[model samples]
Target: MEDAMQFAPSENPALATYSPEVRQQLFRFVLQLADTSLILGHRLSEWCGHGPILEQDLAMANIALDLLGETRSLYQYAAELEGQGRTEDDLAYLRSATEYRNPLLVEQPNGDFADTVVRQFLFDNFHYHFLKQLVNNADERLAAIAEKSLKEATYHLKWSSEWVIRLGDGTEESHRRVEKSIAELWRFSGELTIPTALEKELQTIGLIPEYADIQASMTAHAERVMEEASLVIPQQVFMLTGGKDGRHTEHLGYILTELQYMQRTYPGMTW
Candidate 1:
């Protein structure tokens, strides 16, 4: 049982007294969480009209709705912290494709049921550990959010994990399909655990946990889940990075083009 909220500034006097750089770094990390949820929610929304079954179609939409709401709250708080007066809408829609910091795995197209499951499986596994780390943040507001969201993410991970088992241990075609999806997505996970300099500063100040510690826990969790599911981990050692640095895959560019079309077409458009 790791102390989730110990590092949150609102909960810890020492962390509340950290240097300005440390505080900003912690805020940036929070933005990454918000951005990730927003991007994934959007990706999931594509399933609303396209699911294989009516029940699955509605369920995916509900999940997307949940993610979008969570991301909205997270980014709204981030905007407030920045003091730039930017709204969550601004952060999500006004930014260009390159400005979005979501990992490539999330933005990648949902090829099939297998691809979607593998993508979500990877994301949920990573998020489970990320939320655990954030729960111990020195920033109380963020720590509290993490604590609440961790419960939701836990359910998401469980659902995806079960799907992995169902698909991986199914017929030979099912196994091969999921294995291929896993292999394709495996290379994109490197950026999830690699902390930037800003994150390092926050870690040193106790505003957030160290990336190395979270990575180790996340790796073990993923390995155990896959092992139980009778799946082999992809052996690819090469990994893609730079998404955190604002360099994104081309798929993101197209996604942004579609998502931002109405806003860009009518600059002051509002509900």
Candidate 2:
């Protein structure tokens, strides 16, 4: 048997099975998850004190903290898997925009309260469903992380789902705003659910579930929430992708500019 659990040697101990190619794919897969969380967390952190209301301001901050916490665990695991002598901070702070594999949805600017809410809703639904299955996947290491993160993702989905309904059914203005936000963000929603080359390989090797594994459940939740919200998902529209392939939109550069500034400037500064 291919040493399923002993992914790496004692020095790293991330993944011990599969060929070098599979290991490489899994490394990228883990980084994709970590990068997605880190970027989304950063975007939410941007709204820290700028939310439309005090209660919502605190809520957004709390969600951002939760995502950042997940990001830390993922990056630490990625660092170990890479066996590259890199730390979590190094991986988080040192990467260029094109080097990141996060879907474009998270890197998008928080346009308005409605924009943030819609983005969180779409992703939170998918995150909850995906993590639920991920806990039983091939890799116990990543599954352990997924198990803990799923707890937080549960709250995240509830919060976002409630906000989706609240905003969509609240007032004419709120409903209109969220509708507009959905149009802008919906194109990016398919990227994560659609498999990438690496993601497909991981599925083929039984290392992870195919991205489609969560789509049905995720879509069902979205339909239910959207129905409750009096909103309709737009069909027949073109969806934008490519973030997982390291091709990204213009926004990622600006994000990295601010994100990498401290580390690039000081080279080794710590708070």
Candidate 3:
């Protein structure tokens, strides 16, 4: 695993024993997780009032809250690790689009019902497997957080998976729309498994899951679900990058404008 706190109070040694360099890397990795959740949560929240149905509308909103809950835990930990006075809100709202570490997929626009479903299905698949590995992290704090988040990820994946199958194999119009959504979103899917340079370093130190292992788990589940959905799988799609490196699509700017509106405008506005 990449970024494992292997030097536990028992296993190897305490994390404090690690070089300053490794601690810095761990901070970066945690930010990636936090930023990804924050952006995706905001994206899903957009469907809150626009959902095709009342029940599913609330379902999407609930899932958005789930992602935000995970984001809070991750950002709080990241802030502690960074030893900065920055709060979770600072990390979530104060960062610019160029500073965010979420993958490009999460920041993309939700075009329609099928578009939302495919985007979510792809992300939920990867998130479920990723959290499963994190649940075993030697850092009990992270592992506990991962365990709690896993329950949400489990339901998230199931819900998105069912939607994929429902729309993919349904009426002619529904099937066509879902297939189009899959095609549009498939290219960004590659980035979920492709690690950045920082991740490779973390993998070597056992601080995070191996990209190969995560990719294998992700692929197996995705193939099974897509097969059941009867959706055509895209092959040899050109992959896009840069989100993990803090480069993002323009869509993120618009998302941030709305997402940060209150905090950015009021500066330190609190509950």
Candidate 4:
């Protein structure tokens, strides 16, 4: 059997037992989750020295580091599950833009302090629900990792939500900026709740929760936070989606170029 921290292919002959379509769906879903964490962490790392305040600078950088660490575990587990002789570094830094499975929200530029807060706010809420569901994922190791990660994600959501409230109610200028950021970013959020066909299958089989249930929990939590902050939720219904199907913005290429620079240049040199 695979150890708690290691997944050996032979142990899960179930990998071979499952249909090719099911295997592919599971692999793609894992890759998408890992890619989202990796990209978002990279984006947040860009704010290390540029946050609005010294305290916020430290806070954002800490969260960025935590996200990168999470990405490492996710990528490592993915590579092992795929058994393709690929390291986490190879899977992460070596992938082409079109191969990346991160959602569009994480790839969007961090425009300003308010923009960053709102972006984190939306994603943190989504992560909270996603991780909660994954805590009981049919795959044992994946479920264990998700259970551990839920703790870290919970703190992130709490801290970011506080900032959302503070920025939204702090001052006229702050309120206007955060409100605008929320409005601009709301369209990207619908995708988080819209499960793919594979997701539906998993949910029906008890591998995951229904998307509607997750969305309802998320909406209740989000509305409560917004209400406490005296902020109104944006009423946008139109949404854009494509990340799940391998479409990405041009910005990802540049980001990948930078992320992969050392690895591509140095090949196998390790410290």
Cα lDDT tens digits for candidate 4, 1-271? 0212444656544566656666666777778888998898899999988888899899988888777777776777777667679888789878899999888888888899888888888899999888898887777656766886788789899998998899887999988998889888888887777877767776676656677878888999899889877788878568877776678877788889988888899987676
Candidate order by lDDT, highest to lowest? 3, 2, 4, 1
- C-alpha RMSD in Å of predicted model 1 compared with the true structure: 4.5
Please write out the lDDT profile of model 1 over residues 1-271, one tens digit for every residue: 1211222224435444646665566557768777788888888998888998998787677767767767866776677566577876788779887777777778888889899888988888888888888887757777777887788788888878888998888889988999999888888887777777666776776777777887777888888878977898877568888777788888888888888888899986997
Q: Which stretches of candidate 1 lie over 4 Å from their true place?
A: 1-20
lDDT digits (tens) for residues 156-233 of candidate 2: 999999999999999999999999999999999988788887887788878887667778889889999999999999
Question: Candidates 1 and 4: which is better by TM-score?
Answer: 4
Q: Candidates' TM-scores? A: 0.89, 0.94, 0.93, 0.91
Instruction: State the displacement of the C-alpha of residue 213, model 3, in Å, after optimal TM-score superposition.
Output: 0.7
Which parts of model 4 have CA positions greater than 4 angstroms off?
1-17
Ranked by TM-score, top first: 2, 3, 4, 1
Q: Residue 55 deviation, candidate 1, in Å? A: 2.3
In model 1, what is the error at residue 200, expressed in angstroms?
1.6
- Report the error of model 2 at residue 64, Å: 0.9
Models, CA RMSD each? 4.5, 4.5, 4.3, 3.1
Q: Looking at model 1, report the run of 10 residues with the lowest lDDT sum.
A: 1-10
